[model samples]
Target: MIRVVLPAHLRVLAQVDGEVRLDVEEPTIGAVLDALEARCPVLRGTIRDRRTGRRRAFVRFYACAEDLSHEPADTALPGPVAAGAEPFLVIGAMAGG
Candidate 1:
């Protein structure tokens, strides 16, 4: 299972609490997101584009304690996440004026 941690707002929107676990055949960030969306349809458009299927502007991905800001679509996630040993945190990026 791929553990997922949702931001407070997203959790509230999806009416889910704590970490969510998903099963993914392929160990990629894209696949994980797909599973997340499939499991929680209410969070579909909140994290990624509904049409383009791209990650949202304020959404960020992290793994292996590194920032995957410019990673390609096919980039493989960390071993822990890929092996379903660790969670791919889905945190909401915060901004301020």
Candidate 2:
């Protein structure tokens, strides 16, 4: 099972507590996201753009201490993440004036 830790807001939106566990057949971020959306339909457009299917500007992806928000969607996740050893983190970026 792949583990995903969503930001608080997204957790609330998905009506889930703590980290979510998923069975992902593919190791790509896109595949994980597709499974996430399939499991939580309400989160369809919160993490990525509905039309472009791109990561949102304010949302960041991380795993194994690496920033993957800008990586290609088809890129395979880190070995730890793919092996369910590390949790994929979705953080809501903060802004300041």
Candidate 3:
């Protein structure tokens, strides 16, 4: 099982609390997001673009204390994340003047 920690807004949108657990066959970030979308259709376009399937600008991805927001979707996640030891964190970046 792969663990995913969604930001507060997304958790409210998906109507879920705390972390979400999912079973992903491939250990790629895209696969994990795909699984997340499949399980929570309400979050379809919140984390990623619906047409382009790209991650949102304000959304950041982290795993094993490493930033993966700029990494390719096909890139393999960290071993701890793939092994379900560490949770994949999706953070909503805050910006203000």
Candidate 4:
């Protein structure tokens, strides 16, 4: 099971509490997001673009202390995250002037 940690807003949108555990055959960001969206259909357009399927500008992915926001969606995550030892963090990036 892969553990996913969502930002407060997303958790509220998804109506979930605490970490979300999912089974992913391939531990890639794309696969993980696919699973997440499948499990929580309400999150379809919140994390990624509904048309382009790209990561939203204000959404960031992190795990094992690495910034994965700019990484390709197909890129595989670290072993600790894949093994459920660490949480895959989905943070809502802050932006301001």
Candidate 5:
């Protein structure tokens, strides 16, 4: 199982009280997200754009203290994350004027 920690808003939308656990074979960023969307259909377009399939500008991904937002979708997760030892984090970015 892969642990995924969604931002508060997303958790609320997903109606989940805590981290989400998913079973993914590849454990790539893309695969993990695909599994999340598959499990929680309500979150289809929140983290990524629906049409383009690109990550939203105000969303970020992290694991093992590394900023994975800019990483390739197929990038493999860190050892701990893929091994279910660490949780992959989905964060909402703060924007200011």
Candidate 6:
């Protein structure tokens, strides 16, 4: 199971506490996210758009050294995340005027 740490807002939105664990067959970012959303229905629109299927503008994913910002759709996620050894941190990027 891949460990996922959601931001506080997302946790509140999902009505869940602590870290979320998801079992992924593909060991990819997309797969991990899918499992997360599946487990927490209220998280559906928070991380991604219901129709567009894109990462929400405010949320960002980080793992090890990879930015994964422009990575291909099929790009494999970090090995630790894949192996469920480390948590995939889903943080909200702060922006200011």
lDDT of 6 by residue, 1-97 (tens): 7888899988888888998988878877788888998999888888878898788888888877557655554678888877878788898989999
* Per-model lDDT: 0.83, 0.94, 0.94, 0.96, 0.97, 0.82
What is residue 31's positional error in candidate 5, in angstroms?
0.2
Reference-based TM-score of each model: 0.90, 0.97, 0.97, 0.98, 0.98, 0.89
Q: Against the correct fold, how does model 3 do in TM-score?
A: 0.97
Candidate 5 C-alpha lDDT tens digits along 5-42: 99999999999989999999999999999999999999
Q: What is the TM-score (0 to 1) of candidate 4?
A: 0.98
Off by over 4 Å in 5: none
Q: Which has the better TM-score: candidate 1, or candidate 6?
A: 1
Cα shift from native, residue 90, model 6 (Å): 0.8
Candidate 2, residues 1-97, lDDT tens digits: the string is 7899999989998999999999998989999999999999999999999999999999999999999999989989999999999999999999989
Higher TM-score: candidate 2 or 6? 2
The alpha-carbon lDDT assigned to residue 72 of candidate 1 equals 67
RMSD versus native structure for model 5: 0.6
Worst 10 residues of 5 by lDDT: 45-54
Global Cα RMSD, each model: 1.3, 0.6, 0.6, 0.6, 0.6, 1.4
Clashes per prediction?
0, 0, 0, 0, 0, 0
Clashing pairs in 2: none
**What does the lDDT come to for candidate 4?**
0.96
Model 1, residue pairs in steric clash: none
Residues 1-97 of candidate 3: C-alpha lDDT, one tens digit per residue? 8999998888999999999999999999999999999999999999999999999999999999999999999989999999989999999999999
Q: What's the distance in Å from true for residue 18, model 5?
A: 0.5
**lDDT, candidate 1, 1-97, per-residue tens:** 7888888999999889898889888877888888988999999999889998888889888876776755766778888887767778876788999
lDDT of model 6 at position 40: 92
